[model samples]
Target: MTLVIKPLRKAVLPVAGLGTRFLPATKAMPKEMLPVVDRPLIQYAIDEARAAGIEEFCLITGRGKDSLIDYFDVAFELETTLRERNKLDALEALGPTSIEAGALSAVRQQEPLGLGHAIWCARSFIGDDPFAILLPDDVVKSDVPCLKQLVDVYNQTGGNVLAVTEVPREHTNRYGILKTGEDDGRLVEVKGLVEKPKPEDAPSNLSIIGRYILTADVMPHLSKLERGAGGEVQLTDAMAKVIGHAPFHGLRYEGRRFDCGNKVGYLEAQIAFSIDRPDLGDAVRAFLKNYTG
Candidate 1:
């Protein structure tokens, strides 16, 4: 028998959540539209997806999130003004933000369901191909984009690829923890997944992060729409259904992951990203000195 692995081309970004954690800041805007340094959190996720050779993207959005749909659309009026003013630098900056022709799509998640339901809303856009699901909340800064790392593994292993990181045993109750069957440093055989299990009953410290490269077959399981974990449709529950039948593995990606979902993490991401910028690094570093006084 011969093995055939499809080239990963499409990515789904679930950005529909009401950013209740951020309160008034998110009261009017989607949390994804929140800036990290110069760019919004969603932009970083898009840049990463593009770097991973993704040709198309499906954005799962909710009410008050139309800004995301407008973000990538060509700003004809803005472009016209910039062109007339000969602002070539500003024009060039927009190049990376442009999604491929007919490749950008936005699907609405009618309800404030869980992550699994959010992903299911994009099923029509997913069709029947191997695709990636990237959560904008987890902004990973890496020489090799996090999703690209998993795609490379999927190329060699040919099944499901989940980007994972080791969490503290005490923190296991907060995330989908993985039980490893074999350890190979960067890659490990996924024996089982326990969603937010108590610290003592946890199998391993390996916890699933926001990045995922799932095969099309997993959609059917999600279609069942069974509620799990927090009484909401859990993506972990759907993924667990296909555990034994698929080639699932957790990869310890080499990167600095910033959880932009929470307040502290969001502030940290701003500082971290600012430090990486050539123009802003010096000014930001200088500002940090005044805080000691």
Candidate 2:
């Protein structure tokens, strides 16, 4: 039997968290809007989705996330000024920020539930099609966009494909660890999922990151709204319910994922990303060397 894979086009970004981690700063601004370098963290996620050929985007947002929606809107006054001043370079830099009308939409998650609840809010936008979920808080730097890497696997497997990375066994409690069935180094068969399992109880060191390509069927499980780990609706728990029923697998993607939700991780991302850029790399590297010296 041939498995038909629906073209993965729609993507959901759940940006509803209050970002209490970066309090005072994030007290007003959505964490997704926090700048990694010159551009906001959310821009990197959107760029990754677009690179993977996602056509429609749904931002599952909450309070104080209005800025996220406004970021993509046309700044007529700003653009007019740039054109009048012949600031072509400045105007061109803003090109990618524009989202075509109707191409983007947002839904509100009124409460601070868990990741599963935030995703469930996007069911209406997702309908019956497969979609990708990207967490802005997790930024990945790679030769190929992380989501595109998973999409490649999804095209071949015709099931759910999630991005996984190996973490220290002792730190397994920090993430959703995977139970394995088969492994080929790059792609591992997902036997089961355990959210934030204790190091001793963790089945494997491989942990699921923020990138995911899931089938529409998982939405039904999320609709059940059963709270799991942390007394919140965990997405891993919902995905677990559909494990044996569908072809679920994890892809060990090629990239460095920074946990922007953590202060140290956010600082690391800034340095790493800045040093990776052609224009900023040399200057940033020199500054680092001199500062440390």
Candidate 3:
């Protein structure tokens, strides 16, 4: 049977977590708003989605996340000040921050359920369409946007695709592990998925990261709200249910992923991103050399 692939147009970003890990700083501000170099962490995810041809965005938000919305809105006062000061570069920088009126929307996840539940909150926006899900916590740096790599693979395979990477076998419990069928260096056939499995129970080291291209069929499973690992509705479990029904596969995306939900990873992303920036690279490199030396 020839599989038909939908043109990927929409992306859902689950930003409802309280970010308990980054407390104090995140106490008042949403972790998604934290600055990595200059732009906020969530902006990187949005930028990546746009690069992958995503036209509409749904932010599954929670309380205290009004700033995420504000970040995308035109800052009349700020823009006016920049214009008056003739700061053309500064004004230009804000361009990407604006979205067309109907291109973006937000839905509140009133409760802090699991990832599955947060995604389910966007059902209305995702009705009857295959969509992409990007977790802002997993900030990836790549020459080709990580989600685009998955989109390319999805175009060829026409089923659910996930961004996966090999993790240390001993640390398999930290991620959703993949059970494989075929062996291609860049893409692996996903026969099964296990969430936070112990090393002994883990099928393989290939861990599912934050990027996913899922079929609309998975929504029915998510709607069931079955709680799995951590006693929360596990998206992994729902996705696993679709394995036998779809052309499920995992792409070993070309990128460096930083777990920005944690302090260490967040700090690492800051330095890594700063060192890659044209405006900050030289000064950051010098500071690093002086500090390390």
Q: Tell me the TM-score of each prediction against the true structure.
A: 0.97, 0.98, 0.98
lDDT of 2 by residue, 1-293 (tens): 88889999999999998899899899879999999999999999999999999999999998779999999999999999999999999999899899999999999999877999999999999999999999999999999999999999999998899999999999999999999999999999999999999999999999999999999999999999998988899999999989988799999999899999989999999999999899999999998988788
Error of 2 at 222 (Å): 0.6
Stretches off by above 4 angstroms in model 3 are: none
Which portions of model 1 show Cα errors greater than 4 Å? none
Tell me the TM-score of model 2. Answer: 0.98
Model 3 Cα lDDT, one tens digit per residue, 8-31: 999999999899999888999999
Query: All candidates' lDDT scores?
Result: 0.90, 0.94, 0.93
lDDT of 1 by residue, 168-250 (tens): 89999999988888888989999888889999999999999999999888899889899888888899888888888778999
Q: Whole-model lDDT, candidate 1?
A: 0.90
Q: How accurate locally is residue 138 in candidate 1, as Cα lDDT from 0 to 100?
A: 96
lDDT of 3 at 176: 93
Ranking by lDDT: 2, 3, 1
Candidate 2 ranges with C-alpha deviation above 4 Å: none
